[model samples]
Target: MNYILYAVPFFFALIALELLLDRWRGVSTYRFSDTINSLSAGVLSTTVGLLTKAVGLLTYTLAWQQLALVELSAGSLWVWLLAFVLYDFCYYWNHRLGHERNVLWAAHSVHHQSEDYNLSTALRQTSTGFIFGWIFYLPMAVLGVPPVVFLTVAALNLLYQFWVHTRHIPKLGWFEWLFITPSNHRVHHAQNAVYMDRNYGGVFIVWDRLFGTFQEELDAEPVIFGVTTPLASWNPLWANAQFYVALWRDALRAESWWDKLRIWFMRTGWRPADVAAKYPQSKPDLRQFVKFDVPLSLAQKLYAGVQFSLYVLGGTLLLGMGDKLSPAQMLLGVGWMAVGLYALGVWLENRAHAKRLEVARVLLNLPLTWLAVQLSLLSAGPLLWALLLGYSLVSLAALLWTPRTAVGVPA
Candidate 1:
């Protein structure tokens, strides 16, 4: 039913409300670049999911048709309740393994990369999770839970998670014990040794409690957010690829084929003895920890905000019509959006060539729009052409008017 897509506006509204609360209380929770980068990862995940979601759906449908122990009726209330509870049970192990195993963490680490935890951070999802995530829910299929029930409960579970990402919410008195709340979820996101791998429940906190993985939020030790291996850049693409690249390089350096093969499945952060000795990695001390940031002029911030808004609008449109579009059209739209996002990341980094890259990106849109029309993905009309021309001209004018001194020094 596309519950996630329909919840987009609601998500942004709460983010806006959170921003307002931050101002009123004089406590800062969101950084501009961090929020944008997190949302960019999320947008990329959704757009890419359009192409990759079929993998999980097809596999689950096949498993259900062939291996179901009994046929379960979706109309039965008990079936829905049972599936809702079971899905979270599956999610607990999937999420726990995602943190415990190297291969899985490579995909799940994107969500933990952000140092600033906010509503935007909730949207910071892993695009590569489709690879192994489908296996977690196969138990439901085997139990004869209908596919419709599985998907609905999955969406509801995810939606239930969005509100728990805020810093403004304090610990709920008794609700903290049985359900996943903002307080416990914050502990889940923390990188401190005490909080590193605890609190993995989705909708229910009971699973963590029963399994002895629960950790209460402590008053003495304040939570420090983010991962041990900091994602030090604002680039979304690099954020997704960073851990995988690290593992790949380590595997290449190992002398033994067994170490190379086992490194991926071993406990998270396990490296070959040779690689560990030659090129060791150390965790930063929490006392001196600093969040990643880049200095930017007012113009740069405004430009980034405006351009990101356009991508958000474009991404929303693509998601809404994704099933209706041809494969060629979908590819072109997704590719163009991805390139634009990459350029935006470069701009946030304030690289010396960022202005030129942005100018080139703005110019390319004219032809891309024409191509979209030619492919019949977009309709041909004078108004469409006029709007495109106006946007390009205005964008070019803004780029030309931006001062050379305003190009921020790369962090």
Candidate 2:
């Protein structure tokens, strides 16, 4: 798709623009690793999509069909414009329902995990959105929107969204009324009680204005952006699963089986009494929802980032292999990747909850790393052995192997 070609440059341009605009607005609310984390998640998501497309879950032809349908409409320019409008109308519902449904919320929440409002937040999207998200756009499919045109418009709509993630821009008076300007979208990102679940739109703010979902940005208080239940972690995988794990836990605890299914289908926050009795936490005030600095020392973050970067590259390379490898081979690599994602998510959470799980994440890496090398089917030369040993030992003792976290700080 050469998405990296345009998407990368487009992203960097927005980032530069956001920084300049932030300085102009006197809003300084960005961190290096957090921005990197958001970008990393986006990269991971892109890789996963490539893998799925490779493995055949996502066929390219549906998009082709959607594009071909667009060509059949009468009166070229006017019909294309109408098709674009209709497509956005469908997107508005999809975006709204994403917030209303628990399952969809789980997937969508990844983008909102960051408390900081900046351009990088826009890059963060769920890898899992391919599941059922296509349904919202099916109307275009049924209406015979050319698969190619549909794909192009969808990209344009998404690219439009990237500009709205920043808090740098003030409300454009007339523009605010007509389009999904930065101001209205900032309110959408806000966790404030009054602002939550409002301003659901894709390209045009008119949809939100027309539907009464629009809330103007307030001057009285600043907007605090994030989810109702805080992720409070750096791991991208956990960010995607936080709500989902809660739903699963609730489902298993529910006495009735119906409640189990309903946990996913019901209102985003609805839960059985037993599950509801101890709410996750009350929504945080935007005032108190300040940015968090990672407690680790700079050197540790570098070390961690480096190690994490290797895993990311490994995953990306495996995904890229889908074109070269047979389906069975691709599935084997992807299945192991699924295991790796689960392990990393649990490992990060366990660091906060149970030390053992964190340790297990490292320990498990020994065998996993070996498997990665073995699957490469390369000879166990001294160099390869040394590399494997280094990754395994360091990854296993990542907490201890690093200079700072190595010694006693606290248990």
Candidate 3:
């Protein structure tokens, strides 16, 4: 069962509730550009996962078949409970090393890019995480926990973490002591020195306490969210690639063969001394921090919102039908999604050719859809074709009519 997909509507509903609470309390935790960028990264991650999920599943299944320490049945409630606890134990190390190591951090940093701490920020996830994340769960497989049980527990653990991403929730008196609550998880997301790299537990706060990584939220020192190295752009593609590109450039610049090779695996944000001296990057002053923003016209904002809604709908449909899709069809869908997201990012950034790229995207949809039909992935019926044509025409009209100078600072 795709548990995450079934929870999609509730996620949005909770986000809406958070917004309502923010309004009633006169607090601002969301910005249009930041929230959209966060959600776009999530959509991209989900789309990419459709292609890469087998890597984790197959690896776990193989390990279980070959290395079973004991046979654990899926139907047993005790097995489910034990697996749930055991998965979080593995997740702690996975998440901790993700912060401590450079390569793993590169894959995990996408989730921390947002300056705003809100429900949408929880959705901000990394597309590249599957590359190494499967390694952390092999112990579960080795113990003979059924794949179905492990995946279910992992999904439930993830869903539990979502509600803790909001600023609206304060310290949960007794609950905060045992489980991850909004207060401490906020501390985990913080860039402030004292709070940085503190909490690493997934479901239970007990792991952090036992492992000596726990830090209670300080009332005197407010938490400032985001990574020390600012992402600085709205592009989801760039968000995933920027850290790796920085490391790659540093690797090339390093004079020694050892430094070139070791730099990729060194601590997060660690650059070779020579590279650091020759091409320095300044650390941002937390006291003077400002969130990244770009001006957008009202029409542009409305258009971006409308188009994003369509992408979400398309993503949900893709998720529902993902297993039935061929690799080529999945690739085709991801290609369209990537292009659409990049164009939206351009619009949000108010780039000079934003409108042109958007118009081009609208036009390209026809060829993309025709290609899908040619591949036998999509229906070639007249009604489907008519709908596609109508969609393209309306989108093109909207792009053309959207005002150029309705620009103002985002709220």
Candidate 4:
């Protein structure tokens, strides 16, 4: 039923509501650049998923057809209930291992990179989780959960998680005992020593309770969001690659061959002794930790907001029409999205070169738009081309009007 598609507007609407609720309560839980970066990662993830989701679907279908334990009817309510429970059971392990293992954490860490906890944080996701996440669900396919049932329940499980990413919601008494309430899930996102690697369940909190990974949120200690080793930049592409690059560098520097071979699979933060000694990484002191920010003029902030809104609209269009696209067309869409997002990141970081890069991006849109028409992804009409040209020119005009000193250098 493509439930995720149907929920898109609701997701943004709730985020808007959360913003209003925050203002009413007189607390700020969102930063403009951080929210933009979080949503950019989500946009990149969804756009990339259009290409990679087939891998899991194909693998699940193959396993279900070749090695079914029994023929399970998708129509049965009992079967649906069982699949729902079992999917969360599998998700518990998938999510637990994602935090515990180095390579897996690399793919899963994007969701935790946001320093602020709000509804937009719920939408932040990884672009690369499809690589190994499919294997965790093989048991369902083996139990003969039909692909349709598995897919529907999986979407439901994900949709159920969206609302729990906020700081606006306080703990519910008995509800916290059963499902994953916002309070419990907030602890899961914490980088504090007391809360790290706990509460790995999606919809249900019982998995954590049974598995002994659950920790109650303490009033004495506030949860500090984000990874211990902070993601200080706003780049979506770099956010996905940072951990991998860190591991790769450590692997190359390791003194022993075994260390190099096994580093990727070792416990989440493990590093070779020699590599650790040579490259001492700074872990922030949580008591005095500061959130990453870059100053922007009001015009610059408005310009960024306008550009991001266009990307969001463009992304929604892509998601709706993605099935009709050829691989080449999809790749083209990806390229367009990636470039726009990366440029936005540069602008957010207030890099000295942002102006040059943005100018190039707008100019490049001309050729990219022509290619989109040739690929039949866009209609070949003068008005459409003129609108594209007009957007670029308008953006350029806005850029020129914006103060160059607003964000001097990437902090």
lDDT of 2: 0.69
The alpha-carbon deviation from the true structure for residue 98 of candidate 3, after best TM-score superposition, in angstroms, is 0.4
**Quick one: ranking by TM-score, best first?**
4, 1, 3, 2
Candidate 1, pairs of clashing residues: none
lDDT at position 349, candidate 3: 82
Candidate 4 has its poorest 10 consecutive residues by lDDT at 402-411
Candidate 2 residue-wise lDDT, 1-411, digit = tens: 434435766786878887887688787867755765676677667656755543322343454454444445544676567668878998899889999998988888888888788888888888787776777877776566665566667777888888888766678889888889888999888888889999888889899888889899999857877777877766677676778898899998887788888889887988887766754546665555556444555655565456555656665565445456655555555555555554443333324432344456556655655665556633465676687677767665665654433322122
Give the C-alpha miss distance for residue 112 in model 3, angstroms. 0.3
Q: Cα miss at 133, model 3 (Å)?
A: 0.5
Task: Report the lDDT tens digits of candidate 3 across residue range 1-411.
Answer: 999899999999999999999999998999998999999999999999999999999999999999999999999999999999999999999999999999999999999999999999999999999999999999999999999998999999999999999988889999988999999999999999999998999999999999899999999999999999999888899999989998899999999899999998998889899999999999899999998888777788899999999888888888888999999999999999999999898888877778898889998988888898898877755777899899889988998798665443232
Candidate 4 backbone collisions, by pair: none
Best-matching candidate per lDDT: 4
Against the reference, the lDDT scores of all candidates come to: 0.92, 0.69, 0.92, 0.93
Model 1: residues >4 Å from true position, as ranges? 404-411
The digit string of per-residue lDDT tens for model 4 on 1-411 reads 778778999999999999999899999999999999999999999999889999999999999999999999998999999999999999999999999999999999999999999989989999999999999999999999999999999999999999999998889999999899899999999999999999999999999999899999999989999999888999999999999999999999999999998999999999999999999988999999899888887888898899999889888888998889999999999888999999999998888899899899889988988898888998765877899889998999998998865445553
Q: What's the residue-level lDDT of 228 in candidate 4?
A: 92
What pairs collide in candidate 3? 297-406
TM-score of each model, in listed order: 0.98, 0.77, 0.97, 0.98
- The ten-residue window of minimal lDDT in model 3 covers 402-411
CA RMSD of all predictions: 1.3, 5.0, 2.0, 1.1
What candidate 4 gets wrong by more than 4 Å, as runs, is: none
Residue 409 shift from truth in candidate 4, angstroms: 3.4
